[model samples]
Target: MSYGLFKKVHYTIPVEKINAVKLTQSLQARITGRYMAEVINVGMGDDGTDQKAFLVLYSSRNSMQNYLQMLLPEFSDILAAPAEKQPRVVWAAWLIPFSGYLVAIAAGLLTVLEFRPDFLKQTVIAAAGMTLLFLLSAVCRFFTAGVSVKEDYLILVRGYMRRSVICVSYDKIQHINTKQNFIAQKTGIQKGNLHLLASALNMTQSVPYFREEELDVIKSRMLKTSHAQ
Candidate 1:
């Protein structure tokens, strides 16, 4: 694969040396059913230790996957299974996350307007307009986000204006967790969180506005992989 601007970076890993072919749904390629294809190859680290090179394919979907499988038929089983993705995003699930922001904005606007009574009326109108726009944006973002699970990796695709597709290995995930408010519980909506490599990376990844059943599927796979590792 070759990719870069002025000077392109090329990669050619032998079929035997290929570690894994990860399929993720980035916002760009997600419009069509077909998505992004990634090639994970073995590389040498700065300290002369083994590392990984995640090379993204500019062209994607079944075509790329088929070519690779033709090169190595042994792992066809893994590639053949379609990526089981939870496409549904609960719009109501975003209410709690946005509540605090709305409150803060209201409070700030009130406080600022109190000091500037001369332009209070105009300021209020402007702030209200901007707030509505932001709220609309948040709604679009929540609705467009997606999450998927695969045998070797878990992919989280979030954000609307600036999308991000994070693919973390199941083995790296230390644990899986979920939280629900009274409303969330009643509605069967929960926010899922993933704690990965407790000692190495003290960070948690989230699957926002996820349905209970879909989240359960991801939780089961994540737990099984983490424990096995």
Candidate 2:
């Protein structure tokens, strides 16, 4: 595959938009070839003129062809744009364990009111302990898992003590999984799962937090690399 295969895709968002600056920075550093940026629309208000710009990105035909090859495990096609995305674990996960804590509190109250049981205190303490454990687990899951793609290797980092990294050359990726549980689903947060051609020591570490559109961008880029190689 050659760079000529790619076709340009243009996207523009106002500077005031959340993550806009980050997106621009990533494009400048990570993307290859000719691009353009200019203020398209500016806000006129008492506050000030907000800088608004249009960004043009060129992706060769080869880039698009390569991207098609980097499919995820269960998905046949790459993701289309999803609106109003968010980072994984932004809030849904933090609140999941609290639901259990709420249940425990309700149970404790019921036990104390209906029966003057000494065990009620023990049960409440036990519930608290379990909730603490759940919270810790969520923290670990949030911090330890992520994906990083370099020129040739796509890296996944997972776990604390059971730490490991899996390096898959861009061409070998068989599939990618972007998933969310009921908690994450409701809140519009997602975690990514990358499945490759061959088994590695740790396959699970590739999961990463991503906003929906961000995930699509990554998948597209990885696929482009895979095919280009």
Highest TM-score: give the candidate number: 1
lDDT of 2 by residue, 1-229 (tens): 1112475434444332211100121233223532222221223221343323333223442443243234121111111212122255566755755777788778776877578766777777876787678767667556555555444445554453233333445455557777776877776667766654321322233465555555666667777876776
TM-score of 2: 0.47
Q: How many residue pairs clash in each candidate?
A: 0, 18
What candidate 2 gets wrong by more than 4 Å, as runs, is 1-89, 97-116, 181-189, 200-206
Give a tens-digit lDDT track for model 1, residues 147-200: 656666666666665444555666556677888887678788676777653222
Q: What TM-score does model 1 achieve against the real structure? A: 0.60
Which residue runs of candidate 1 sit more than 4 Å off their true CA positions? 1-54, 60-89, 148-155, 162-172, 196-204, 213-229
Top candidate on lDDT is: 1
Please report how far candidate 1 places residue 47 from its true position, in Å: 11
lDDT of 1: 0.59
Residue 77 in model 2: shift from native, Å? Answer: 30
